[model samples]
Target: MDKNILGNNVITQIGILVHDIEKTSQAYADFFGIDKPDWSMTDTADIAQTEYRKQPTQARVKLAFFDMGSLQLELIEPDHNPSTWREYLNEHGEGPHHIAFVINGMKGKVAMMERNQMPLLQKGEYTGGRYAYMDTFNDLKIILELLEND
Candidate 1:
């Protein structure tokens, strides 16, 4: 097992891959009885390609972030073309995609993973966080993340 002490800013976020962002966003909003979280958009294919992961054959995605108490829930849907999430939905439907664990000392952690031959599947900086993805059990299904303190 891997062992590392996460910094105080560490936050845990869950990612839900969905077919409809609005529907999923509403569900969470209604459940929480709070205003829907904000939205974010990006074309992550470039980064995926660099990591040798499946290239997203989509234009972009409409992603919404929902705050649930302390954790943030991310809902993703392809706004154009198709994506890995879309494919996952086509095959399995909406469900949990991954869990993001925010942390500090990211570079140090990443280096350790590398020295142990468990280099991240993908790594990059975004939204005040340095993010890295590592698959659970060598399976590409679940992504384990290390997010920098933000």
Candidate 2:
């Protein structure tokens, strides 16, 4: 594993795909003895552009974040449509979807992953950052998300 390819080995988030964001978030909060989590829906415009399985598409998701000191716990609820989260939930049910790492050199790292035979599954932009999800489920049994924030 080239260190420069993926930047540092610091995981910033653990994302889970769920059927219901509110319910799942409440469950997590209850189990962890924390307050109810607030869910935020992704803005349509903020996505800018999106691609799934190399095809242009639309994926709406409601998200909730829980801070756990170093890493964040992210819950994702997919709209009743075709999306990565929906596909994951339909195929594997509710569970861990991906592990995200904050990378400074996002574009370079994405290129390196491509060179290493990891296909990009999806890519999108948010308010102050962008993210790319790589297909590593077969090899690592988990998707890898590379995020770059401004």
Report the error of model 2 at residue 128, Å.
0.3
Tell me the deviation in Å of residue 3 in model 1: 2.7
Poorest 10 consecutive residues by lDDT, candidate 2: 43-52
Local distance difference test scores for all models: 0.64, 0.85
Pull out the clashing pairs in model 2.
none
The residue-by-residue lDDT of candidate 2 on 1-150, one tens digit each, is: 444577688999999998888888999999999998789987673354766777766777899999999999999998865667778889999999999999887778888888877878888888899999998787778999999999
What tens digits encode model 1's per-residue C-alpha lDDT throughout 1-150? 445534443458887888777777888888888897767776465543323133324345678987777898888775535444454557677788667777668878766766665655655545555667654535435766777757
The segments of candidate 2 whose C-alpha lies over 4 angstroms from its true place after superposition are 1-4, 45-47
Name every residue pair that clashes in candidate 1.
none
RMSD (Å) of each candidate, 1 decimal: 4.2, 1.6
The candidate maximizing TM-score is 2
Q: Per-residue error at 110 for model 1, in Å?
A: 2.5
- What's the true lDDT of residue 109 in model 1? 73
